[model samples]
Target: MAKARSAIVSSGPVGFLPVSITFFMAILMLLPIGSGASNIIMPHLVMISIFYWLSSRPLLMPYGACAVLGLCIDLWLNVPLGLNMLLLLLTRLFVLNQLKHYKGRNRAVHWGVFAVMSCGLYLISWILFSAIHSEFWPIKPVLMQWLVTAFSYAPVAFLLGRLRRWAW
Candidate 1:
């Protein structure tokens, strides 16, 4: 007798999903909003996607890929070099380490963890940028950025969750 395949976790790597998601994020980042006023926060898009894949399938989106994506974001956004890269590495490590906590967790739990991770990512980038630029980077801006990033997390998480549940 032949066996049936499940919709969850097809016979392939997670790199494909993260790659496509990250690419989509980069495009959204480039889109100009309201004549360059109050643009959408996209850095967390890739990060959230990366964190999802990293937490869900750490073997697929490893540290190297995370580092590369972070470097790309840094160069593309003209932010301080190595800052995002470091955060990417750290995020990957955190997810990889905390995989057990995510098992069968609720959506709010996952999204909340992503938001907290976003805060970490933003703080890392800010500290690195301030260290290099020697400018007064206030906590409020970072807090606002984290809040905005938290807002952006829902759709991506929902889509990813559905994809994991309904796709092969």
Candidate 2:
């Protein structure tokens, strides 16, 4: 019985669960479900996935995967090339670096960290976009996006946790 249990536990990565989940998230972000106004408040689903997976299972979610998915998001959103890629890569790094602080902590800590990181990422993006266009981009939409993404993090993280348990 011990041998059987160990075998089952050691069965390294049963499938492409991590990448597929993150890809599904990227697809969700790409879907044109709402009007332009609606998109302004769209949650950063891909970022959420990257952050969750990195924190939960860094081995399964690598920097290369984040970069690829970010590129897809950048292309889909038609933003400056590599914008999402940069953000996603940064997210992976940030989560990894800060993982020690939150690894054994409660979900609330994770949510708080996520909220702060999401806000920072959006602010950086807004700055970059403004610099690229050489004009002051309105801050309202950025704030809306940060709020939506921060509030949505808990539910999304919960769902991802469920997926991780089921898959792993």
Candidate 3:
């Protein structure tokens, strides 16, 4: 109970990312702007959110967290169950593979690379998912999602950078 109480109190500072993630998802779900006009193949918001935590604080945000978050995404967004699990797994692997590239860089370079890599991974993921499903969804929507997600990258990164020291 004491641990729970402290957890609740400590949450005051650490709550932003999780809250922002929900906000992004809420916007993604509620907004019908891109519905008839376009369809985004890659789930960029979820991908970007996962990438942020993976880069910023791997210890506090584990693969299990990623997996659960992915599952929540699947449940909340009503996508395939293991699809996001696979994406999260691949994202974790991608970040892990590039650990050296990140560890020795300034935060700007790091987040920049994070944005680029997330964009690339989303592309590859779109291909793989399309292939697995045996269809090409579309290019325009995915590209639009890339643009929006990349746009979101900077602010989320700025916030994460501010919270970096607190993460440890």
In lDDT terms, which candidate is top? 2
lDDT rank order? 2, 1, 3
Give the per-residue lDDT of model 1 (tens digit) for 1-168: 122232233335543666666667766765666546655544467777787777665666767777888888889878877777888788888887777887578878878888887787788777777888889678887887788778878887778768766644
Alpha-carbon lDDT, every model: 0.73, 0.86, 0.65
- Score candidate 2 by lDDT: 0.86
lDDT score at residue 108, model 1, on the 0-100 scale? 81
Which one wins by lDDT: 1 or 3?
1
Question: Clash pairs of candidate 2?
Answer: none
Q: Which segments of model 3 are wrong by more than 4 Å?
A: 1-43, 163-168
TM-score of every model versus the real structure: 0.82, 0.89, 0.67
Which predicted model would earn the best TM-score?
2
Each candidate's clash count: 0, 0, 0
Residue-level lDDT of model 2, residues 18-84, one tens digit each, is 7888899889877677676754456889898888878876877888899999988888889999999
Clash pairs for candidate 3? none
Q: Which rank order by TM-score, best down to worst?
A: 2, 1, 3
